[model samples]
Target: MASGKEKPLHSLIAGSTAGAVEAFVTYPAEFVKTRSQFGGQKESPFTIIRSTLASKGITGLYSGCTALVVGNAVKAGVRFVSYDHFKSMLADQQGKVSAPRSLLAGLGAGVMEAVFAVTPSETIKTKLIDDAKRPNPQYRGLVHGTISIVRKEGIRGIYRGLFPVVMRQGANSSVRFTTYTTLKQFVQGNARPGQTIPSSVTFGIGAIAGLVTVYTTMPLDVIKTRMQSLEARQLYRNSFHCAYRIFTEEGLFRFWAGTTPRLARLVMSGGIVFTIYEKIIAVIGGRE
Candidate 1:
């Protein structure tokens, strides 16, 4: 059993394991989702999947899985660690965490993940996905792509959409954790003391939280994708610039371009990650 002092470490371990599982299961959906948000493409998720499979075979769906899996592991670990730390700091005299405090902790977690993990990972993943659709691809694979970006655009290139990514992630984690915690609390409040909530119920709650997250911050996500997918000094100057351009050129609805595939990926990934994470934490006798 993990003591209070070791709870944070357990969260890190469990979160990483959950992230790896989520990434592996949802990466194909992620590939198509990213492609759909690439600005000019109007293909439905099914059409994109069909064309990609026809042209690049089944392998195309997993174009950037390596970078994404590694990144998500680290991202989830840092997120849970930072969130737990922040939550403890924000707890009231009664040791209760309010919704606003939970939101703040999640915001902190998101910033940490964005700076340390998501930026580089998403940049590499987006580039690889874009390259896969090209006739003559520039980067060979993950390693080559990383090296190419560094050689051409330097370290900054790898963190292409840092600001928007931070914004999106900040809002994502804030809404997700806040909503999930609120829902979980509401469920527990109605249940008998010491009664366990089923894993299926927890998973359902997580899916709802993920849906809230996607809707609340999708515009920023679109801008982040657009900014990261381009060359270092390309069409869009910054997040605001990218948002302006997308709104003007593509119309308002374009901000949610990849909604279908994104919803599928997030709903399933969120449910699986949270359910597995909670189960692992329980097995380790750690505080949730």
Candidate 2:
């Protein structure tokens, strides 16, 4: 039973380790998503793709990789840790853990993660993802960019897109962790003693969960994107202002300016991350 906490601890470590590697692999898509949010007028896929390949070469795909690696690693760590804690809470509340318990656990983890990471996450993401073409110039690397933002904008500025980040990320994580547990159960239940579940099953579940997460929290994510990019006039005036600023100044419609692209990116990036993370776990567990 000593392995109990040790094993669960591994989930957090595995998730975070997997998050970092996954972020590096999909950085190009992330670069595309961020640039789209901040790129503004003529920020179409074709142009950004061409511009990046032309200016930065293949390495352009990994432009903001360092920040993404750190940010996503921390995010995944917190998410797994929080989920573990919350799952216990739900279990205690109900006197036992179950799939439904996992849902609540996932929900709590999502909300907590969002609350903790909202500002800094958005700030870093914004700073990293900000279009290199923008007239404003900053540092050369992730750390430099983050330090520059804090120095120039203050503590509050470092967490510029706090509001939407919480909403979108919270819901996304809630669904992700919850669905992961549920799917794991389904797989185990159906597996034979000497057999294992198919990778396709895990991938399918992760993809479905990702799609649901993207759609559920899409509007907030869209606002976060614009908020990070300073693409919205109201959101830009006082970057520290809360989401209410968007509601009051531009109306709610303004919050979802770039949801289409954001959703598309989430489908592939988040889905792939979820799928690959589980597959990695299986591989590490000695599954052939």
What tens digits encode model 1's per-residue C-alpha lDDT throughout 248-287?
9889999998888889889998899889988999889778
Error of 2 at 10 (Å): 1.3
TM-score per candidate: 0.96, 0.78
The number of the candidate with the highest TM-score is 1
lDDT of each: 0.87, 0.63
Model 2 lDDT per residue over 110-179, tens place:
7776666545765676666564655554557777877777786788766666666776676777776666
The runs of at least 3 residues in candidate 2 whose Cα sits more than 4 Å from the true structure, single-residue gaps closed, are 1-8, 92-100, 115-118, 230-265, 268-288
Clash pairs, model 1 backbone: none
Native-referenced Cα lDDT, model 1: 0.87
Ten residues in sequence with the least summed lDDT for candidate 2: 1-10
Error of 1 at 213 (Å): 0.7
